[model samples]
Target: MLRCPNCNTHDIGRVGTNQFYCWGCFIELTVNDGKISSIHQVEEDGSLSSLNDLFLGDGEQDSISL
Candidate 1:
């Protein structure tokens, strides 16, 4: 029951063992130790643009539902 951190949608799919993709906002979220360690946005050309700086401002951790 993992949800997207950005869109807060339940439309998340597993792209890897610990990698998840959000169809709602087209963002990739990687979870490690129950916390979001990486966040990337899917570009039009299928490239990943790091959105971590925008969401992860300061030294704080964001947890996603698993």
Candidate 2:
């Protein structure tokens, strides 16, 4: 299973094709080609705030569950 690098939580639920939501931290994770291309936080206004810079490492590639 894909784990959240921040919270190390595995409570990820698929919200769309190749898109997953982290129930633990209430964030959105988008995986493409077995890599996470974007991370966003869902706001109360139903908007997205980019959280990639906080979570994505310098050379870390996105991960996918088998």
Candidate 3:
């Protein structure tokens, strides 16, 4: 099970390959090489804002190893 970096919620929904959606914070999660690399929040304008820095502990280094 994957955990949401933003809300620390384990309620993540798989949306695609290496991609997940966080129901807790409604953020888009993108995993790479078994690690979470990017986090985007869906804006009211239907745009995405990068929230990776806010969620990731060590930015790109917090990714999981496969």
TM-score of each candidate structure, all chains considered together: 0.89, 0.83, 0.77
lDDT of each: 0.87, 0.84, 0.77
Where model 3 places Cα greater than 4 Å from the true spot, the runs are 56-59
**Prediction RMSDs, each to the true structure:** 1.1, 1.6, 2.4
Which clashing pairs does model 2 show? 36-62
**Residues 1-66, candidate 3, lDDT per residue (tens digit)?**
677766887888888988788788889878888877788998878799988667665644565532
lDDT tens digits by residue: candidate 2, 1-66: 799866889898899998888888889988888888889999989999998887786957666663
Q: How accurate is candidate 2 locally (lDDT)?
A: 0.84
Clashing pairs in 3: 35-63, 35-64
Residue 26 Cα positional deviation in candidate 2, in Å, after optimal superposition: 0.5
lDDT per residue, candidate 1, 21-51, as tens digits? 9999999988898888889999999999998
RMSD versus native structure for model 1: 1.1
Model 1 lowest lDDT segment of ten: 56-65
The residue pairs in collision within model 1 are none
